[model samples]
Target chain A: MIEKIDGFAYILGDDINTDDIVPSHTLTMRDVDEMAKCTLEFIDPTFAKNSAQGNIIIAGDNFGTGSSREEAVYVFKVLGIKAIIAKSFARIYFRNLINLGIPGIIVSWNESIFSKGDNLEISLNEGVITNKTKGVKIEFEKLPNFLTKILEEGGILNQLKKTLKG
Target chain B: MGYTIAEKILINHSNLKSISPGQFIDCNIDLIMVHEQLGGRIHKEYEKLEIDYVWDPNKIFFILDHWVPAPTISAAQMHQDCRKFAEKYKFIHNFGYQLDKGICHQVLPEMGFSRPGMLIVGSDSHTTTYGAFNCLATGIGATDVSVVFATGKLWFRVPESFQIIMSGKFNKGVMSKDFILTLIGNISTKGAIYKSLEFHGQGAKNLSIDGRMTISNMVVEAGAKFGIFQPDNKLETWLVNRTKEPYKLVTPDNDANYENTLEYNLSEITPVVAKPSNPGNIAGIEEVEGIEIDQAFLGSCTNGRMEDLRIAAKILKGNNIDPNTRLIIIPASKEIYMEALREGLMEIFLSAGAVVGNCTCGPCIGGHLGVLGSEEVCISSTNRNFKGRMGDPTSEVYLASPAVVAASALKGRIADPREVL
Candidate 1:
């Protein structure tokens, strides 16, 4: 439901799969904080140790492939990831982000534009991603108006609640 | 313009009749399936809403799978929660632990609730497996599942179609699993990303309903929204005795527009494996043949069917399992387990010194049973060879068809099934 957020950027590479997002063994705890400790530990052993709250993640194409585990998106939500901008997203990952009310923006791949800890800004309504550090901008294709309404409601749960009451 | 199978089904179910790829529309859901793991989460949300019964209990089904019989205290609690919810709602249910007939994907069809030209959604990615029967199925998260429960509605952005044309025929000991794995190898993991894969061509038509399932189950590994085939006599025969529910059969028009059309000749299909850490990281069996493994797993939503068990049994008969390897056979559902037992496939597995696990996902999700220890190497029929997929991240997972898995178990190496078959 909350929109127009700005944060520093965190960059990860292509096909950073579900296992890397949260290992299967760590799923015992649903507490966001407890589960967030293992975030991306499968691939980057140092990620959990280095996560910064309010940082946005910019990923390469096919981000969040493998396994339909939502922990991948859950940890980021807990960590307060401002938004995610990717060249492309695996279908279920994109769906999970929408259901969770996370801003998932798709942009064409540009290696020269971003570096870890860069200044990033997204205009959700306009579908534009700007890298302030490099002074570059990319236009993203707009999502359907229906999904935009859900995201504006801060995820599907709130949307469902409203629908049920009505 | 003509429409693909997925588009046709989505259009029919949506509030509107005409739609295009990338356009979002709300549609009525035909079925909602969930397991204990997800059902527990949905229960919490359902309570939070304070609803009066469900919108339609008959449209929903619960399965006590994913750590069947309760592998841990928490798992037991989750299963109990699912059971309690099912009891309160009196929804259609299948508990593998009690009746030995669960595994939502396989059981739904085996029991015949799913049908051609339907819009199905589940909380598990392998829900796409239902597409083999020509239905449009996809996976979503717990929150989405909860929404569907509150209202029998969900929204989808129609996906563009990626048509895969499979022609020719299977080689000796080669099956749909092998060709599909090979196709994944060539396509890479993200090749299909958000698109739907509509399978066609003579090669696909020649595959048994079981074999088509093997192909559809892993389409998610290639980043596909769904994988499906045209309805055939094979599926009709399987369904004739199971249900009399009136349903429609949908086929894409010949002039259907495709984002891209990929053609493959199945006669050239080779035995392959998705090396550890990636399902798309494939290599020919000859390249990795002599590599030894610590375990061999033959089951998952991807393979654990009667045909897969029969394939493994056909290769394992009389030949003992290599003492160096641990082979675990987990049938997909209770019906498959019972069918295997009736066919005497269980005796062969026992004689081969394989551990016959229950009708559950078992170690595929690393929930329990057959978990690989650190540094262990495993050849499996399960989908997704992601890092630590079967157990330890340091351990290696090789994705193969049941034939290769069975043969490798007998040889203690990644040998092709043809060597033994």
Candidate 2:
């Protein structure tokens, strides 16, 4: 299966910590819509309002560092983030995203080539990323079979659900 | 090729006879620690599983410390949900909504749940703190933990191991916190992402259990998956009375394969602080000295043990906190709180104009207690210094050892601990 994800890029800088993604104070709120409003509120007050559905997050190193608050990733899920491409990611954050069936990609950062609002096309099977706006193609290491299996199955919960049914 | 301690522990817990980094393997979890997230963030995913009965009720623990005393009505409701869940699942180790129990990381070990050669997972990031006992412990998200609750098993992509060999003794006022802060500065926060850090050498072996816990607790700051120590007499002796569970000490083979090795002589390290906005933004005492602070915090899962309290008391006994600065002290667990009270450390703190609060993660996560105001600067002994971690995003935090936090509170600025000690 040639799984592909394409979306407009939303650029972010280095060390976009979990606190910046989903501030601790907002964790008490039960509504996903209310929590999504505060996504990246600390780093950019307009992020939640401006971000469009199906937008991909392109970031610098150490994205989603600090705190194991899955709400940080949950906000992105709620914001309709299609995929996350970064130079690196914190271990727990990356794991959380993958467990939730979100595509978290790590690439060697090229600051000059990718710009905000650039159209991006990611091929999960081919391990290639195409910058549609700039006409540049970059390759990345594909996720391992087990991880892709989890993603294909619509996250660990669904996988577990299937196993339980079996 | 020999396996690292992390590999050995993973292999011990799993059915695999041989394991290496990046290979996904399912391992039986020895312990699962839960906090408020179990009722809140984790509950949503847990319900998806639709499994009413846990795999093993005895294997799980619930400690409500993050929002202890429930500052908000919503938080109080979450506490109610947690109590109902515990009752439904028959979790025997549930600590309930007790105000005295304290942080899960500290309280779990004190209750004899953590042991060497165990695979422990918690919903909180600082769950790595249990690695001080040589356990292959790491943190995971709510969805992952939800699955563990039903199966008593979790998967791991065995992390590549890094060797941190420590030698020599720490200088006065320079403690494990200084060593870890300096190391995090040296190896940027992203340096150890997806890697396991195994502390070794004479200096690591010589550290008290409290000091070792402090080191393991902050490994998450450097993005390390686990910060395990080499088990030795200190841990073995300490565990003698804490647990009756017999366990073998897992150690790396003499020729264990390491992704990288770094050596440090503790004597050469001095008191350091992580400047505002990041735990990796390290600055020595001289570099950040005399920077005025509005508040000083002396507690967290990172440095809230009895040893940390004693270090603060030594400097605060005869001195009053600066009138302009507010000081807050919280012990990590009820055991540590009782110990501090018995040792008269609580008196020194109270007489020094410091507010001694019950054990809660308040203020650390900006949840409650003594939150900071905008533009305020605080010197804290807590682990993280991320923006708005203690309060408003505009407020700044300087991370230091207990000695530095105590001395800074007295001077109303970032002060050198050596001067007071």
**Per-prediction CA RMSD (Å):** 1.9, 1.1
Q: Write the per-residue lDDT of candidate 2 for residues B223-264, one digit (tens) a residue.
A: 999999988988989999899989889888999999999999
lDDT of 1 at B149: 80
- Cα lDDT tens digits, model 1, B1-421, are 8999999999899868588998878899999888864544567767766677777888986776677766787777667777787777767554524637757789888878779998998888888999998899888777778778878898787898999998999888887888888888888888887789999887788889889888888899889888989887777887798789988888999889899999999999988888877888889989999999999999988999888999899999998999999999999988888888899999999999999988888899888988889999999998987788778888999999999999999999989899888
Q: How close to the true structure is residue B299 of candidate 1, measured as C-alpha lDDT?
A: 92
Docking class of 1: medium
Model 1 chain B weakest lDDT span, ten residues long:
B93-102
Candidate 2: Cα lDDT at A61: 96
TM values, all candidates = 0.96, 0.98
Tell me how far the alpha carbon of residue B251 in candidate 1 is from the true structure, in angstroms, after superposition: 1.7
Q: What is the TM-score of chain A alone in each candidate?
A: 0.92, 0.95
Candidate 2 wrong stretches, greater than 4 Å: none
